[model samples]
Target chain A: MGITGLFLISFLMVHCFLNSLIFINDGGETFNLGAEFMAKNWVIRAMEIVLFGGLLWHIIQAAVLTRENKKARPVAYAASNPSANSKWYSRSMGLLGTILLIFLIIHLRHFWVVSRFTDEITSGKETLFNEMKEVFSQLWVVILYCLAMVSLGYHLLHGFKSAFQTLGWNHVKYNSMIEKIGVIISIVLPVLFAAMPIAIYMGLIK
Target chain B: MSGNMNLTLKVWRQKNKNAEGKLVNYQVKDISPDMSFLEMIDVLNEQLIVKGDEPIAFDHDCREGICGMCSLYINGRPHGPKDRITTCQLHMRSFEDGQTITIEPWRAASFPIVKDLVVDRSAFDRIIASGGYVSVNTGNAQDANSLPIGKEDADLSFAAAACIGCGACVAACKNASAMLFVSAKVSQLALLPQGQPERYLRVHNMVAKMDEEGFGNCTNTGACEAECPKGISLSNIARLNRDFFVAGIASDN
Candidate 1:
């Protein structure tokens, strides 16, 4: 679970970096060039398969873990003070991951399915930024993206350091540093992903 | 500390595993502040015995903190209202006059109610039996200092060894995770030379046994540590994960 999670963390970094190219504000020239490279590149395409596999494996692991968690406590406590134990984000990883799954489904349907299964993306001739504009044109789509980003933020906040901790990468001297880095990465990545759709909807990015 | 306090008790009473359980209320008059929490329970039991009623059943062994037998969830905190103290060590002085204290057993499917406050903790025992010890030869024990372990490692291992296999960590967990308990055992042995031969297998087999027994994954809540009578730190859990992760990669060959 931690391995796949860290894999996605790295994937998100590359994903967000690519998405940020749209902010170049050069009318989608650079964004489409990058998108074309991603679409046509064999290595990136192969990695895409691995990414999907990692995603599915992670989802399955989560479902099993959550089921086992529920089974562990057949009867709920009459009273609990969970906030006193850990941060809400840390405790709510399963819920956040589920939400992120929903976001991923919507996101893939909007972009990936079209890009791969069919030539509907028209990426070679038409810039993919237009795809973004069309998708974000709907207020609800933009809203959903923003909402999913919130879940992603919380998920990453717990997940980043948890991955390292689970992998035993923790050091007494460096554990705090890793946690601080995890916090910064969690917030920054999701905010950037969310900003793209909001900016497009508001005409901040054209 | 000489004064006595009047208080109402809401204690869970269940006939057995299949019976429906509920909070049965009782009143105790003049509970001495000087008495330990279990002593007060003893007083209540004596009252019930004189009245020819079934006395409430709870788990306990040594009145001191060492034994992990006492597993009461009092006022929503395991081992009563005090921090780092078992139910046997909690004092009546922690309560106020006319206070209503609610007591319940550990809530977990793995720990079904046996009769009242006592739940079956054999699940923990099974996990321990799966692999909680070193594979030692049947002979005279080696000299303690022969292993040449560092003082830092020795102290940490001792602290982890302090775990008495109490199910409080499971009861205190939101997910009912036994990570702290299992990790404590894992760390205790894994730190020693005796555990070197089966270190990887111990974590692998023990964690599998834990899951097979239907315990939840560790979410790193730190609740187990806070409620632990022995003050078992979450660092042990981190070490367990590290060992388990390494084992997984290593065993791939």
Candidate 2:
């Protein structure tokens, strides 16, 4: 879970950075160039396979772990005050991961399918940036993206530090540093991803 | 400092390990505010015994709280609402006069209920048997100054040693994980020079035993530390993880 989680986290960094190119405000020229490179580059295409593998593994591990954990206590507590001890998000990783999985399906359908399978971009009929603008044009799509980003933010907040601990990288001397880095990644990455759709919808990024 | 008052009690009653458990309500009158939580239960038990009723079966020993024998989940919190104390250490004063207090046994697949409020925590004993020990020779007592151990390591080991093998960490955990208990044992021994000869073997065998015992994995939720009666720190868990990983890679066996 930790290995795959950190793998996906790194993927998010690259994805967020590439998508943020739209803020160049050059009528999508820069963003489209980057998107075209990502789609056509053989190395990127190969890494995409590994990326999907990591994602699938992370999801499957989560499902298996959740099931095993549930089985560890067949009898539920009649009344448990879990919040008194731990953070809400720390205990809700499975729920947050499920939400992110649902969002991933929607997101892949919105952009990835069109870019990979369809000839719209390849035939010069449409560009990836124009697709983004068209997609964000709908208020509901924009709202869903924002909500998904919120879920992503909370998920990463716990996941980043948790992965370190699971891998035995945690120690008293460097724990604060690791946690600070986790906090930064959790906040910055999701905010950037969310900002893209909102920027397009509000005409801040044309 | 108030006078004794009446209170309602909802205690879990299970005839045996195979029998179904339920919360049976009973009213206790004029319970002293100064009494310990277990003492309150003793009052109810006396009432039940006098009336020809089966008394609640619970675990208790060394009421001053050193013994990990007492296990009770009171009012949704393990060891009651107070922090860093066993159920035996919780006084009636922490609760209200007319409150409805709920009592329960530790619930976990690894720690099955033997009766009403007594669970079979022998799983912990097995885990300890697997690796929680040193294989040093026991001759005449070695000089304490021979080791020349650092104070920080000694303090850390002492803190980890404070774990009483009580399953409160498991009861409070959402996953019913024994990581805190296992980690405490690992940390206590791994920090000492006498524990070095079998360090890798200890962590390796202990973790394997823990997994085999059907305890859940630790997700680092921090519940175990928060509810631990001895105030065991989460750093012990980190140490366990570190030693476990290094053992995986470094151990010849």
TM-score for each prediction? 0.91, 0.97
Instruction: Kindly report, for each predicted structure in the order presented, the TM-score of its chain A compared with the true chain A.
Output: 0.96, 0.98
Docking class of 1: medium
Across A79-104, the per-residue lDDT of candidate 1 in tens digits comes to 56666556888888888988888888
lDDT winner? 2
Best of the candidates, DockQ? 2
Name the lDDT value of residue A12 in candidate 2. Answer: 94
Model 2 lDDT tens row, B1-253: 3488789999999999999899999999888888998999999999999999999999999999999999988888899999999988998889887899888888899999999999999999999999999878734547656768899999999999999998999999999999999999999989988888899999999999998999998988889999999999988887888898899898886
Clashing pairs in 2: none
lDDT, each prediction:
0.87, 0.91
- Stretches > 4 Å off in candidate 1: A117-120, A123-125, B1-4, B135-142, B245-253
Interface RMSD of each: 1.5, 0.9
Write the residue-wise lDDT of candidate 1 on B1-253 in tens digits: 3488988999999999899999999999989998898999999999999999999999989879887998888888888777888888899889998999999999988888999999999998898899997768624547765668889889989999999887889988888999999999999998887788889999999999998888888777678998898999788988999899889888642
| Residue B192 CA displacement from its true place in model 2, Å | 1.4
